[model samples]
Target: MTTYQETVAAEATIAEQAWAETFGRAMAAVAGCFARRETRATMAELVAGLLMEVDTRNCWTLGQALGHPGPHRLQHLLSRARFDHERAREEIARLVAGELAGQEVVLVADETGDAKSSTDCVGAGPQYSGALGGVGLCQVAVHLAAVTATMKVIVDRALYLPADWAADEERREVAGVPEEVVFATKPQQALSMVTGVLASGLDARWFAGDEVYCGRELRRGIRALGLGYTVGIAATYQVTDGAGHRWEARKLINKVRPEQWLRRRTGHGAKGTREYDWAWLEVRPDDTPGGNGNGNGNGNAAGAGAGAGTSVLVARRHRYTGEVSYFRCWAPGDVPLGTLVEVICRRWRIEETFQLAKGFTGLDQGQVTCWNSWMRWSLFSLIAAAVLALTAAAVHDGSERQPRLVPLTCPELIRLLRAIVLSPPARDRDHVLHWTAWRRHHQAVATACHQQRHRRHDQP
Candidate 1:
């Protein structure tokens, strides 16, 4: 009979192998995006560096961690390297879709910002960044994520350019912004990304977003693609109730009877089940003029034909704070309130994706200023994140359940990956001496600059 310790060791080895194999296959799927063998190899190394633990995931540190003499090669990979990052993005979407096959999928849209100190960076300006918690100088990128019960992965992204940035030719040239690129709103960006992902043949049942994406264009666009939506709307959004009366979402929801509100669990959380009181009221679809359900002015009416679809205004109240939120919902048939609430809850998954991508895969750690470099770095970081997510999902599916043990998570999986699957950084005497000399040389140059500045100030 095998001893308990031996069995445990064997299982651990198997788990490590699973992680290695999963990562290898994911990288291989996107290999075609790079034409030359050398570029492909460098791309692989850059991704590996992103996966490794580094204080800052710029070319300098990543190059050093990967045992390189200088940051030139990695910098080139982001800046001037001739590789099809757009194709790579498509490949990433397909890879994620394949991994999540046979699962209920919801396409989620959101944007994230990286704070910047200077306006020299492309798309960096005073903007409202939820990540920054207010208006700040930053670069915002809109992203669309595919989510399921147990997995979430970002499938597409686009950099948001402010109006002035788009019109400034000199600054655009300096930042390498393509001439064809122009200013598009966040909802437009989300619509474009979602359209591209769906056009790539990735099937999703619903599209979800926050209040920012609750515009008529995006809603009608999503419905045109034959997908339902449960998008948040501002409390003041106008809606026509079933009685043909127009009222603000908040005012309309207040009319709901106390007994009509049903308490339902959205999903399981760290604490326990997230339960909320939900209520629904039938509403006139906004596709028609005056929302009268009569004439179509935009040629995109919700439920254009009889028995085609249904639209409703849904509200959710917190069980504790009693604070209420509203959503404008549409579905093909008369779906239950629970289904719409589930989609509403899944909107939070994109936020979770932002956190994981930034934390584990260095999604927001790029130091580049040019447009192409920024895009390449973001795409590579996302690829690294996808690898971790796929590995965690695979490990959880295959591993035996133990009492009192939670399922494998992306962070824990990354720890195991660095510990076993990834090659350890070189720690030999020669390697250590080289890094030591390099750091000291850098410090010497910095000290010289500081001393020169102080001398100039003293003389003045």
Candidate 2:
């Protein structure tokens, strides 16, 4: 007879097998990046080290993650390895598409900026960091990710080169910036990533981004490729009514009747469903359209008439505060309002993915100064994130019905990885337990204080 302990043991074995199979597939996807057998072996080691629990993700820390005393091999792999990171990126995209492909999957382009203190760090400059929510010294990268209902993973990334860095030959040489690297706007960078991913044969049903990537050239480019897109637009963006009347997005909000708003849940959150009221209205491009699409209405007067297709302006209102936001969507055929809303909701998945990658896999924790090294680190970190995401999907999904519980989250899976795979010694384990206990105690105290205040308010 199968006892409870035996059943648990069997389940553990199955889970481990699942992980091993997925990890093997991920490694194989990037195997062609390495030319020599030794480099291939080193690539495996680098990927495994990135998956392990470590204080940081650098050559030295990764050596520690692999239980090594030095970082020479890892350093060589990043700094002097002969493999092309771009080809590796293609493999990563292929792997992600295989794991989480759907006809309705969204291709998302967004910029992530990590604050940097050192001026010598590659691409570091005083720039506006969306991650930091303000202007600061940082390195910015444009990321292209594939997102669906079940998973989100970055498939391509490009570092943003500031105009000064691109113009200064001496600084470029010192930082090892490629000779071909030139200053391009964020939207232009996004289009290049989309073009590259398309060239690699990866497919997506829709393209999406924040307002930063919603330029005239980008919209036209996507249309030229026969792709649909839903991108955020500033409140000041102008569009024509179906009758060729021009109005800014903000102005159209007042034109929406109360009956047009639908209260819907945007997505699931840590607490519960994220509910908001949404409304949409049909709008068209101008009669003539050769402009930059920067919302300044300059360049080409053919703005709304670029494709002579249907476009929609969407408005979202916070249920509690009544705060409102807006988005513009351009899709082929008669796309349902619900479908467009779902596409807009999927935008938050990219933001959540960034949080998970940075928090668990150290997406922004590299200490490299060279351009190639930074790219290598990002590739490895993304690989680690992919493993975690795939493993979580396996553990939570599948037909094996052993026990039912809340689905595993990225943080929980990361903790399990640390406990089982990293296998900290007794002393380190004890320290972690102590830290957890302290945190629990602090939470208890805060909860008690909150309850006391509530009780007093009720009595009064």
Candidate 3:
């Protein structure tokens, strides 16, 4: 007779095996990116360390956790390893597309920043980072994420280089920035990544972003690709009505009749359903064939043109605070207010992706200072994150049988992997002594360099 405990144990074993198999396949997909067998092995181990519960997933700590004698091997993997990280990123996108085969998908554009104390790091400078809550010294990277009903994964990323950094040859050489890499605005980076992803055969119905992406060029580019968009806009942005009257977004919302505002639920939150009052007004498309006479950039002359999609300015008012937000929306034909609200809600999925990637896969934990090292570390971290996300989605799909159990989350899945699949951390005396010696040796070198600088200053 099969007892309850025996049944539970068998299920647990099956789950562990499934997760291990999925992880292996993900690593195998990127194996061709590395030419050397040695570097390939190091890359696998580095990804494993990122998945583990290391305090900080930088080279030093990750090397120690992986039972290496020192951090040199991992450091080489990040800096000078002969591997194609860009190709690996494309492989990741392919893997995700396969995993989300039948679900409806959308492309989401967003950016995240990692705070840096010093300016030596590549692309680090004073910038407006939501991660830091304001303008601060950080390295910001624009990312494009693919979102489905139950899954979200980052498909592409580009580091934002400030204007000053691009013009400074000395800093560029020191940081190993390529000559072709120049200053690109966040919106431009988003457009480039989106275009590349679409060209790579990833099908997406719509594109979504924040205000940074609501520019004339970006919107035009999105339309050219034949994808609908729902992007945020500032309150001060101007629009034109069918009667050739121009009105600011904030002022235009007041004209909406009291009964016209409908209460709609965006999605579920921790508390409950997130409901808000919504209203939309049809506006003019800015991507007309020729220039409009308004000179305000709104295509008022293209009103009711053949094959032109419906353009509208949508507004959402909070249920409690009454604070309103705005969005510029477009679809092939007229879409319901509910559809626009849903797209607006989906834009927030990228924020959740950033949080999960940083918390579970050490997305922002790299300590690299050069362009190549930073790119390699970020790509590997994202690969690790993608694997976790795919595994969790698979687990959640089979969770309906147990009504009492909550859906499997990335953090919880990681905890289970650490317990069952991953090897226990090495705590032997020899392992501890090895890492201790390595740290002290590096400390000595850094101290000597500082002392030499001080002596040179005194001599002058």
Candidate models: Cα lDDT each: 0.83, 0.76, 0.83
Better of 1 and 3 by TM-score: 3
> TM per model?
0.90, 0.84, 0.93
| Structural RMSD, model 2 | 11.7
Question: What are the per-model numbers of colliding residue pairs?
Answer: 0, 8, 0
* Model 2 Cα lDDT, one tens digit per residue, 1-460: 3554554444455556667888889888888888888987888777766656666777756665565445678888888888888888888777776776554678899989999997688889999988989999999999888787777778788899889877888877888888888999888998888887777777777889999977778887877676778889888988766665778889978899988889987777779999999988877632223444433343322222344444778889998999888888877666777888898888878887798878777789877888888888898888888887888788767525336434566776666666666444223555555545655786799999999999999994
TM-score of candidate 1 versus the correct structure, residues matched by position: 0.90
Candidate 2: residue 435 lDDT (0-100):
47
Model 2 weakest lDDT span, ten residues long: 295-304
Best by TM-score: 3
Writing each residue's lDDT as its tens digit, candidate 3 over 213-267 gives 9988888778778888999999999988766678999998889999999999888
Cα error, residue 426 of model 3, in Å, equals 2.2
Where does candidate 2 stray beyond 4 Å?
1-12, 286-309, 399-404, 421-460
Per-residue alpha-carbon lDDT of model 1 for 303-333, expressed as tens digits?
A: 3232547688899999999999999988877
Worst 10 residues of 1 by lDDT: 295-304
- The lDDT of model 3 is 0.83
Runs in model 1 deviating more than 4 A are 1-11, 288-306, 439-460
